[model samples]
Target: MTNYKINMGRGFKATTLLLVMSACILLSGCAGKAQTGTQGNAPAPGKGSAATNQNNTGGQPEQQKKAVSETEGLPSGVKVQKVLKDISLKNNYHKKVELLTDGGKRITITDPNGGLVLLNLEYEGTILEVSGRKVTVQLDHGGQQTMTIPDNMTIEDDDNLGLNKGVEIEWTVDADGNIQNVELDD
Candidate 1:
């Protein structure tokens, strides 16, 4: 008659959960820092203005900062020249960068991706397979790339590899995705 017993489901221990939460909180402050360029000299606190007269402890009035024009080094009253546009990079697939030139004039720059430009690229991977002038390479970061070799694309197989070989390839491709040069590193 005393065979009846109680059964309860298992639950997480509070001590273990607390440790994980504490670790996450402590590690959250280890994020990368931002990159800031050179900073200008800041005026001391309590200074009214650059032209305000303030006596130092040595009894000398503070010097006022001189105002210089943007074209200080150039001829007087001459307009300063600046870039009108940038095409080294692209903000989007079809977006062209706009820049301000001299006299506050705006100019537009065409993206290099939209036109033909010579680009040299290098990749180190294992040659998984090779078919005629086409080669498939397996990258070190778990990926593969198939390269098409054109008649004008130079190929220098220093490694003398056929298949399944660690190879480094240097190639140049045009903006139209056409291979123009290929060099295999030893």
Candidate 2:
């Protein structure tokens, strides 16, 4: 009977020790302390010092704005103060037709019809050719080209002002300085 009691005591002690050790470990993990390998969340190497300065000053960081393309001039009566990206098109009911981008901003333009149009603007816009439903534009980079108005798609000008939903168009100067072949939608 003595031996049995001794064994029970040993088991109880072991269980108690385990529970205490577990609690200590959990409590240690919750303690707050600066971690190694980083200095108070400082900016890493290669990032400009401007970011850190802005954070330290508690002021908003200055954003670098993109310049407007010379080729993509504003229309005669319509002034385009800023070029936007990520334009969207949807039906009158607000159903999403597509997402447009000037390569960055998401623009959404609703059409009178139940169709949505999304425009993705490039850095520099150049009208190369509008063959059938395919409209190709010259990219800013030399020899590179971007095409809009995918094949097997029907495009109708809602405003009849040259810009059509789901169609890509660009203005070009001709010998007579007149806008020609402006509509390219496939």
Candidate 3:
């Protein structure tokens, strides 16, 4: 009986040691694969070129600029002429309103219920549009309002304006110089 007990103890120790060694080997293999950087050898989704891969890895790429909305781009060269508030149009009426850009060229606004709004420079304040993160404003006269600008919108030091930050417009302007009534384009 004593010999049998000793054998059992030896067998248990051998099994435990084998399990421990197997676990260590498995963990080491995983670490090696990670170090090699060849887990799948396939590029991750949305990670194509080196630049895109850097962006995917939460690393900013060289020569790549951060994207800014169109309204933010407007207030730089342009200046705000006036701020139209309590604008009682037929449809929407905004609370805190601001007209931005040099000739009131661009409109940056925040409404009570509505979200962020942006007007264009070329078009007079007649054309108003709403874009929370993005927007498309159609002028009451003619043309389309786009919230996409390639470069970063910058504001230089020039006091030909009243409002400092951005403003929120309550109403949307149509292409015909009328308040925006129709639903936004998808």
Better of 1 and 3 by TM-score: 1
Off by over 4 Å in 2: 1-55, 62-124, 139-144, 151-186
| Tens-place lDDT digits, model 1, residues 38-105 | 22442343333344434333211112111222332232333334533333332211212212121222
Q: How well is each residue in 52-164 modelled by candidate 2, as lDDT tens digits? A: 45554522111111122222232233223344332222111121111122221222232322122222222334446545444456543333334444333232333332322
The 10-residue segment with the lowest total lDDT in model 2: 59-68
| Candidate 1 lDDT (Cα, 0 to 1) | 0.37
lDDT of each: 0.37, 0.33, 0.35
lDDT of 3 at 32: 66
Error of 3 at 146 (Å): 19
Estimate the Cα RMSD of every predicted model relative to the unseen true structure.
24.3, 27.8, 29.3
Top candidate by lDDT: 1
TM-score of 1: 0.31
Identify the candidate with maximal TM-score: 1
**Tens digit of lDDT per residue, candidate 3, span 15-127?**
65886798567546744654587646634432444765554564222111122243444533443445554342211212334454333334333222234433323343221
List clashing residue pairs in candidate 1.
Answer: none
lDDT pick, better of 2 and 3: 3
Instruction: Look at candidate 3 and tell me the lDDT of residue 42.
Output: 37
Kindly report which residue stretches of model 3 are placed more than 4 angstroms away from their true locations once superposed.
1-73, 84-92, 95-101, 108-111, 124-186
